[model samples]
Target: MKNIILTLALLIPFSGFAQEFPNLKSTRQDEDYSFLKNDTINKNWYKTMKFLPINESKSAYFSFGGDIRFQYFYAKNENWGNGDQDKDGYVLSRYLFHSDLHVGKYFRAFVQLQSSVVGGRIDPSPVDANPLEVHQAFADFNFINEKSKKLILRAGRQELSYGSQRLVALRDGPNNRQSFDGLKLMTGKENMSADFFFTHYVAARDGIFDDKSNQDRQFWGSYFVLNKVPLLKNIDVYYLGYKRAKANFDDATGKEIRHSMGTRIWGKSGNWRYDGEAVYQFGDVAEKNISAWTTSINGGYRFNSIKFHPEIGFKTELIRGDKTKDDSKLQTFNPLFPRGAYFGLASVIGPSNLIDIHPSISFEITKNIDWIIDYDMFWRYSGNDGIYAPNTSLIYPGNTTTKKKIGNQLETEIVWEPNPFLYFRLEATWFQAKDYIKASGMGKNIFFTGITTQIRF
Candidate 1:
C-alpha cells in the first residue's frame, strides 16, 4: 500500500537527461553525438551537455551524461519462502554518471561511476549495496577508423555484450550491473564485426572502493556477428571459455573448466520476427568429463492492421541437466553472464537445468505508453538435477521423488514513456507452486510486484 504510493511518487520530472535522441542506446558507451557538432543553431537543447569543444579542437571533445533509477519490490514468500522473507518489501536506488573524452579520432577514454543502495530490506545481498565505486574505466585506441569499418583496441574495466544478451550481457536488470577487467580487440565493418577478449569478472563488494577483479575466475571468448548476408543474414557465432577455482553444482563442487560454442540466427519480415540459438558445452570438472548444451527458439508476430498494434510473442528453452548423480560425467549447462531478466520482469529463475515455455502479448495503450501480459511454465530438464537461481546458485538437490514440474508464473507490466529521458513501469507477478516444489520442502506460492522509474541524461 504505502510502498506502491511511494513508488509512484519517485517518478519525478527529469526532462534534463542522458541518451541521445531517437536511437536511445541501452549501453551508454555506444552513444554517438557527433551529429550535434553541426547544429550551430542549437536545434537540440542537450547539445550544451553532450557536445563540448575541447580547446576549440575539431577532433577533441568531452561529453558528460548520467542516469538515475528507482526500483521498489513487494514480494510475498520470495523464492517459495526458501530464504530471506521480507513482508515490508524493499526499495533500491542506483546512480550512474559517466564522462567521455575523445582526444582525437584515434584515442579516447571513458569512465563511469556507480552508486547503489537499498532500504527496508532484511539482510541485503552483496549485489544490492555498493555505496560508491567505479563501474567502467577504459581506453579505446583505434588503429583504423573509417565510415564503413573500424579496428580498435580497448583496455581496462569495461562491459561486454553480444547478440540478444542470451550468453554475455551487461546485467542491467539488477541494481549493480556486471563489469570486467580485461583487454579486448575489436574489428568490424558496418554489417559485421568480431570481439576477442581475455579477462576476469569483477567481484562486487558491499562497501566503497573495495570492489576488484575476482582472482579465482577467468573468462575468455570470441564473438562474431554478421548481418545483411545473402539468404542467411543476421547470424552470430561465438566460442566462450571459462575457469573457476571453485564451482558449485548439485552433484559436486570443485574446480571447473568449461568451453561453450554456439550460434544464433534471427531476422524479421512482414511484421514477423524470429530468433533461434543453439549451444554445446564441453569441459572438465573435478577430473570428471563434462558435457552440456541448451537450445532456444523465440518468435513474434505483430498485427499492423489492428488499432492497438499488438504483438504476440513466444519463447521456448531447453537447457540440459545432469544425467545421473552417481556418474563419472557431469552435464549442467551454464548460462554465462546472461541478462538479469532473462524471461521478462520476474527473473526469479535462471536458464540452467530447466525447461520453460513462455507466451506474451504487448500492445500500445497510447502514444509512448504500452502494456504487456505474459505467462511462463517451468519443469526440470533432468529430474536428477535440481533447480537453480538467476546467478546459477543451486536451489535444491535431486530428491528421490520423480516430480519434475516446478510451477507456473503469470506476469504483467505497464510501461509509460512520456518523453525521451523519463520512463516508468509497473509490474506484478504470481507464481503458483506445484507438486515438485511441494515435494522438495515448501509449497508456498509467491507474489511479487515492482515499480521502476528511470531518468537518463
Candidate 2:
C-alpha cells in the first residue's frame, strides 16, 4: 500500500510538467537525433538534457542521455511448471547513461553504461545485477554514399533487431537487457535496407567491468527488408546461423550448429493491418540432424474515429517439436534471443516447440494514456515431446503423463506517457495452469502484477 502511494506521487507530477514544458528543441535539422521521434511513445531523451551539453557544432557534436527504471513485481505460484512457490513482492531498478558522439555523417561513436540491481526477491537470479559496464560501444563509418543509397560499416559491440522480434531481440523486458559484441555492414536506400553481421552474445556478470562476450557461442546473419516492392507492402528476408561449442537437448549433448532462413511480410491498409512470418531451421548437433521450423501470423483492425480509439487483434504461432528421441534427429525449434515479453507481458512461455493462439484489444483512454488486454492459450506441438520454457529448458520431459495442454493466460497492461521522456506502465497477468502443468507439480495458479516507471533523460 505504501509503495502504491509513493509510485502514484512520483508519477503524478510528471503529467503536470509535460503540459507546462514542451520538449526541448534539437539543434540538428533532421528528426534522426530528435529525442521524441524514435519510438512510439516518444521516450527518447538524448536531446532533453541540453543544459548539460559539453559541446555543440555542425561537424562535431556530443550529447548524453540517461534512463532510470523501477519496477515492482508480485507473483503467486512463481514456478508452477517445476514446482509451487510464491514470491509476494520484489523491486527491480536499472540505470543507464550513454554518450552519443557524431563527427559529421561518415564517422560517429556511441557508448552506454548500465547499472542494474534488484531487491526483495523470493528467489534472485543471475540476470539481476551488473553494477556498471559498457552496454554499447560502437563506431560507425560510412564508405559509400550514392544519391539514393548508402553503405555503412559498423564495428564493436552493438544492438541487433529485425522484423517483429519473434526470433532476435534485445531482451529489454529483463532488468539487464542483452547486448552483443559484433561487427556489421549495413547498406540501404530509402525503401530498402540490408544488414550483415558476425557477432557474439555478451554475458552479463555480477560485478562491474566483468561483462564480456560469451566465448562458447557465435551468431551470424543477414537480414534484408524491402518496403517499396510491388504489391507486397513490406517484406523481410533473413538467414541466421548459430554455433555453440556445447549444447544439450533431447537427451543428447554435443556441439551445435544451426541455420535458420525465414521471411516476414507485413503491412497496413486503412484501418486493417497484417503480419506473417515463417522460418525453417536445419543443422547438426554433433551427429544428430536438426530439422525445425516456426510460423506466425497476426492481424489487427483499429477504429481510430471512435471514442477511446480501440484496436483489436489476434495472433497464432506454430513451432515444431520432436516426436520421439529414438532417432538421430532433433526437432525442437529454437528462438534465438527472442524478446523477453514475447507471449504478453508475463512472458511465462517462449516460442519454442509449441502452438499458441492469442487475442488482444487495446484502446486509448486519453491522449497520454492507453490500455491493453490479452488472452493467450498454449499447447505442445508434439504430445510426445512435452513442454518447454522460453529459455529452452525442459520444463516437462517427453511423455510427462501424456498431457499436452499447456495453459491459458489472461493479461492486462496500462501505459501512461506523461511526456516524451517520462513513462509509466502497470501490468497484471493471470495464468491458469492446465493438465500438463498441474499433472507435473503445480499446486496453484499463477498471478503476476508489475508496476513500472521510467525517466528516459
Candidate topping lDDT: 1
**Predicted structure with the largest TM-score when compared to the true one:** 1
Report the number of clashing residue pairs per model.
3, 0
User: How high a TM-score does candidate 2 get?
Assistant: 0.89
Q: Which consecutive 10 residues in model 2 have the weakest lDDT in total? A: 23-32
Clashing pairs in 1: 17-457, 18-456, 18-457
TM-score of each: 0.95, 0.89
Q: Give each model's whole-structure lDDT.
A: 0.86, 0.78
lDDT of 1 by residue, 201-280 (tens): 99999878888999888999999999997776689999999998898888868998999999999999789999999999
Clashing pairs in 2: none
lDDT of 1 at 250: 85
How much is 307 displaced in model 2, in angstroms?
1.8
